[model samples]
Target chain A: MSGHGLVLRNICKKFGSTNVIRNLSLNVIPGEFLTLLGPSGCGKSTLLRIIAGLELQDEGSIAIGGREVDGLRPKLRDVAMVFQSYALYPHMSVAKNLAIPLLMRRLCAWQRIPVFGALLPGTASRKSEIIEEVARVAKSIGISHLLDRKPRQLSGGQRQRVAVGRAMVRHPAVFLMDEPLSNLDAKLRVQMRAEIKELHQRLGVTFIYVTHDQVEAMTLSDRVAVMLDGELVQVAPPQEIYANPHDRRVAEFVGSPKINMIDVNVCGGRLAEIGGQVLPSELTIGQGTLTVGIRPEAFHLASSGEPNSISAAVRLVEHMGSDLFLHLDLTGVPDPIIARLPAASGHIAPGNRLHLRIRTEQLLLFSENGQRLKQQASVTPLREYAR
Target chain B: MKHCRLSFRTLGRHGFLAITTAFVIVPFIWMVSLSLKPPEEIFQASFSLLPQSWHATQNYIRAMTASPLPRFMLNGVFICAVIVVFQILICAPIAYALAKLRFPGRHVFFNLVLVSLLIPSQVLALPLFILAYQLGLLNTYAALVFPFVVSPLGIFLFRQFFNTISDDIVHAARLDGMSEFTIVWRIMLPMAVPALIAFSIFSVVGHWNDLFWPLIAVRSQELMPPPLGLMAFKNEDTGIDYGPLMAGSTIVVAPLVLVFLLAQRWFIEGLTSGGIK
Candidate 1:
């Protein structure tokens, strides 16, 4: 089957008086997995639903495979969705569930007779073809043994596989998944993540995944669309999102042990007063008040001749297997600064006074209005700190 | 002394349960006993529990022949079946719409249905009678079954049950490329089966026992229901010939009791699920 790309143009959806999606636009490449990532009520799920044609937008246009599908019914759209709850038909066996889309496609209306269909003319071959196709898909998903069981009889992970198997049987042009792995346990979620990634590679079909989990988006998506308050803020590959965020919100949202932001003054051609302590960024931003964004890993244990070491008292020490997270209380800083160091460095403890250095190149500078601060290409590189 | 006290406590507990059971069973037992008694001793205080003479077959024959009981029962069955099916078809869609669909005037329409529930059936009887007369449907099965089929009660129950189901299921079906009607038919309807069966029992039993609508709507003696037929039978078989009327009455009550026993589990679950509130 040929792959299809989807496009949403100036789409705005409103529910009653509330505007859920505000003039959002995005383009999906053929045979790519794109994820919409945001928190609850952030319109990520609503945006996905709008794309599926399950919901109508108040104003905008949608195109699937380069054709406008404004008034087309959901059945005519040729998109398969894997739901968070799975939504398997409770009355039907797993095989029957997989056969439904094929049946709707291949069988004539009159041949859908509950009792006479098998005996009817020209129906036997079609029925067997559909059944064989369903079996093939079930086997591919490793759920061939569960073909006869009802959904309720299956475990959560098995049910998820069946859901994927059902979607696979049709081989629709686009697959829309709304948090399909959220219901699984932690281990199952991780296992399913890899399976789904491999499934995308094997099928090479377009997938539009919606989730509130950042890690899922980072791991699973070829491109991630970051949404906030129903608006598309940024869309980029995973590494670019973490290393070069477009906005201050993106930098803070995309990392675990979130990025530390401190208010600063970009005064008189120099970086001054980083939370009332002088900082060394040599090339200054525009002369205005700004905020400095620093990832926890960007800070290191200070040594002699480090350009921007700030002194602080350690408030708490947490030893994870690979690293130690230090919560530090500096004299001028309003909030505690966090530092992540190698676990082998066993030198830090709670209530100890220490000097920690901020890696200059890794520093993220933001404008006062939460916009990222850009610099010229000639900035100094800290080669030893690179992971 | 301790043994005596324990015995008394156990006796009190069993006595309370036995008394409550008797109270629940008494009306049913009395109906059966009354159906068996001879006409002359029907109201007598010293009447024997068993009949002085057996007229069981004879009473059944008279009940059939002396009145239009057979025709009335046939009418009851036809009317009840039609109403039950119509109630499900009509109420299920309305309930599905109110429960799932987002549209203008939904809250207003739901409130109107609730208001209709508050107005007692007796208050609507005159207006309904006039409407039936105006439509020239008087004395027909349509007059009895049409208006009663769109039960506010069934809609309320189905709506409540549908609300318990997550909307994500509908989205899943939609993305599977199923039409809205197909989604309702294939997904929501199956999930709402327990509610539907419960509502069916209520509708069937209600229409089976109702006499007022049939009495007011049907003028032909042949179109009467079981309850109305029993009333007419009681008047014609007066003066110690109570056997036929009692036999007919027993027949009328038996089906409901049997149906309840057969569906006892579902019936209780339905009632507690939908009606306890």
Candidate 2:
């Protein structure tokens, strides 16, 4: 299917006095999967709701399939959502649950009446058509055998699939998902994550997914929109967002084992921690204290005789099987800085002091205000990864 | 640990419940027993729970044959069914609006229902009676059915049960392209089967045994419900034949007892639990 695109312009929403979505505007390309990633209560779900017309925006307009749908109802907007709780009709069997949307769309008022409805002209034909369609979608979702069972009889994973199948039957212009897999167990979550990715590829539908889990956003989307405090902080491809975050909040929120923030000052063209020299600056800078963000993987064990290696004490060592994370304390830095090294790289235990080098090329410098400062050097040359 | 030795607290609870149950049930048992006893035994000085001899066939035949009792029962069934159906049709949507829909004055409307609940239907009897006379509905089945069609207690009960259903299910239904009424009939009502049963039992029993309202609004003998007909039967002939009266009482009470027994599980669950999950 060739998916339709969505354009949200200046969407603003407020719950009572507090702003929930602030002047948010985004353009989603046709057939592209975009994820809205944020912390809980950051209004990503509210934004998705606005796009689906489940909730109206206080100001601004939304377009789906190139048509303005600001005042339209959710069903008319040609969009379907898989809610976090599944929201399956408790009274309906799986088949009836799948057949409901078709029933509402295809049957007239009198045509849906109990006994007389069966006697209505074209009702039987339409009903049989609906059953066929429901069967097809159920087969596609691998829930064909479960059609006779009630929602309560199904496992969590099965319910999740049925929820997806409900939306899939519609073939709407856009698919909206609000943390649909968050309710599953960890193993099921990982397994379902791949299924969702494959589903996205197979349908090739424009998808707007809202999630608080960064890993889901990173793995499932063609582009990820990082939201903070009701505003979009940054929107870029996952790799680009991870490597080059435009805002400090985005940098801090995106990575696991978090990117460490170190306070440093410029001394004789070299960057130094509060009480000791750290790394030599490759780019020219004004003389003032700044924050430098360094990813854990950017640090490496220094040779005994290497220049500019900072000697630090290993406070804790976390063995992650393939890679080992060493929590180290520099002479001046109060908090421990973590370094992820190859697990095969010799035995390093807690309390063992090791000299470590910072790959100057991969070093991220920030002004006092928490904005990333680009360096003059062009580097895939993360001067650290070479070691 | 699994032995049947009862604690003091458990013994007290069972003791209190048993006494109340006997107090409530003894009259019905006595009625059934009296219906089986000959008229002379019913007036005997000696008290007995069961009759000395069976006059059940004669008493039941007399009850059925006397005073158009079958006609009275049919009227009761018709009035109760109409009242319950219309009450549900009107109350479910009102309850749905009160419970789920977001609109201006929802709180005010729900508060009004609660306020109406605080006032007994007897308080409205005067106005309803006058209105029935003005509409020429007095002595007609409409007089009995109309006054109860929009029951506030039903609205309140249904709204409470609807409140327990997740808002997400409603949202999902709306997105599935169902109209509000469709959601009420197909989604909300089916999910609320227990509550409906509980409400229907309350409605059917209340109207089935009702005598006071029917006495005021409907005066014709043929239009009278079972309870009212039984009263007319008492004043008709034989002055006060104890046997047939008890037989009619048993007949009138039988259907409700059977209904309650059949739906006892759901009736209890509906009263205690709010929603399916």
Candidate 3:
């Protein structure tokens, strides 16, 4: 089957008085796995439901496979969803659950009666065909043995697989998953994440996955759309989103331990000063106040008499197996500067004095209103350094 | 000394339970014993747990032959069954909508149901009797069954039960291409087995033993339910036959007890499961 692309244009949704999704537009390419990553109550799940036709947007148009599907029901839209709760029928066997969509679409009303249907002509063969298809899907997902068991008898992970299997059996053009792995334990979540990635690869169907977990978005998505407060802040590949975020909220929301912010003064169109120390820079912006964002990994231990080095006292050090995060109290800085270094870098203790250095290329500059400021390519030093 | 005190508390609790159990069970035992006794042995001053003479077969035969008792029982079964089936059909959908769907005046409708529940059936008996007479439905099955077809208790019980089910399951059914009709009957109905069972018990028992409505609505012997027929047997113009009256009472009460015994497990399970959830 050919995979279909989805386009959601200018979608705006309001719940009573609160605007949940505000003029949001996104285009998902065919056979690509796109993730909408955001915090809880950020309207990501509402957007997915709107695409599936489970909820109608207050103002917007949605097109699946080049056809507008604004008024179509979920089943008619050819989209299947794997919910966060799995939402399996607790009383039916796994096989019956998987066969429901197919049966509903294919069989007539009279042909669906439990015992009488078998007595009708051509029903026996059709039912066998459905059973065969269900078996094939079950075997592919490695849940063939669970076909006879009810949902209550299965573990969380098994039920998750069965849910996925149910969605796959329909062969829908698009698969929408809403936090499908949040119910599983930590270890099982990782395993299921890989399985979902594999399934997308095997089927080559367009997937629009919504999740609040950053790691899931980073590890599984070909492109991640970062949303904040019901608006699309940034949409790019994971590495670009982490490094070259268009908005400050995207930068702060994606990374662990958060990117550190320090206010710096740009002097004479080239020079930058932090904490009363004039630092070397290649910036050509006019004299103004700028906020500098520095990742913890960008800080390195200063060599003896190294240029652009700042002295600070270590307040705390957190050992995280392969890396050590040092909380340093820099002079004239209100908040502690956190630096991530190699675990075997040196013998460091609390209450010790140390020097740290950062390269100019690793520093990001933002205007007072949290907008990124482009930097000039030419290198220029302060007048003191020129002397 | 501590062990002794604990044993003393256990004994006191068990003793209290034993007294209550006897108080409830003694009347039933006395009824059965009286039904088994001959006419002379029933009035003796001395009380005994078992009848002095075994006249169970004779009494049962006379009760069956006396005043169309079997026909009355059949009417009772037919009326109760029809009433229960209609009640489920009428209540389940309204209950589902009230519990899950949003609409204007939903709360007002539910409040009306609650208020209707507080107003006992006896209060409506006169108006209902007049309406039945106007419709020419008296002395018919419609008169016996129509008043209870829409049960406020059934709707209330089913609404509470349906509220306990997660809405996600209903959404999943919709995504699976099921119409609302199929979702209610196929999905919600099967999931509501316990509630349905409990409702069936309540409806059957209430309508089966009811003497008030049938007494006012029905005038012909053919339309008399078991309770009305039993009353007729007691107050026959010939005389009061205590032995046959007791026998007929036993027959009238046996079916309800048998039904409870058969569905006792499901009855308790349905009530407790809905409560815990």
Tell me, by TM-score, which candidate is best. Answer: 2
Minimum summed lDDT over a 10-residue window in model 3 chain B is located at: B237-246
lDDT tens digits, residue span B25-94, model 3: 8888888888898888888999886788888888888899968999999999999999999999999999
DockQ of 2: 0.73
Relative to the real complex, the DockQ score for model 3 comes to 0.70
lDDT of 1 by residue, A1-387 (tens): 656999999999888899899999999998989999888899988887787788899999999999898898777887888889998888889988889888877887667666787789879999998989998898888998998999999999999998888788888889888999999999999999999999999999999999888989999999999999889989999888888998998998898888888876666656455533455455555576777778899877766345546677899998888998889897767899888889987677788977777666787877777878686222222332222
Error of 2 at B3 (Å): 12
Query: Per-prediction count of colliding residue pairs?
Result: 0, 0, 0
Model 1 lDDT tens row, B194-255? 77778878888999999888889987777888998888777765435766777888888888
What is each predicted model's overall lDDT from 0 to 1?
A: 0.82, 0.88, 0.87
In candidate 3 the C-alpha lDDT for residue B235 amounts to 79
lDDT of 2 by residue, A1-387 (tens): 879999989988999899998998999999999999999999998898788777889999999889999989988998999999999998889999999888988999899999999998999999999999999999998999999999999999999999999999978889999999999999999999999999999999999999999999999999999999999889999998998888888888988878888887765554445223345556466577777888888888887756656788989999999999888898877788888899987999888878877765666777678888776322232255235
Clashing pairs in 3: none
Give the number of the best model, judged by DockQ: 2
Model 3 regions lying over 4 Å from their true place: A264-290, A376-387, B1-24, B237-239, B273-277
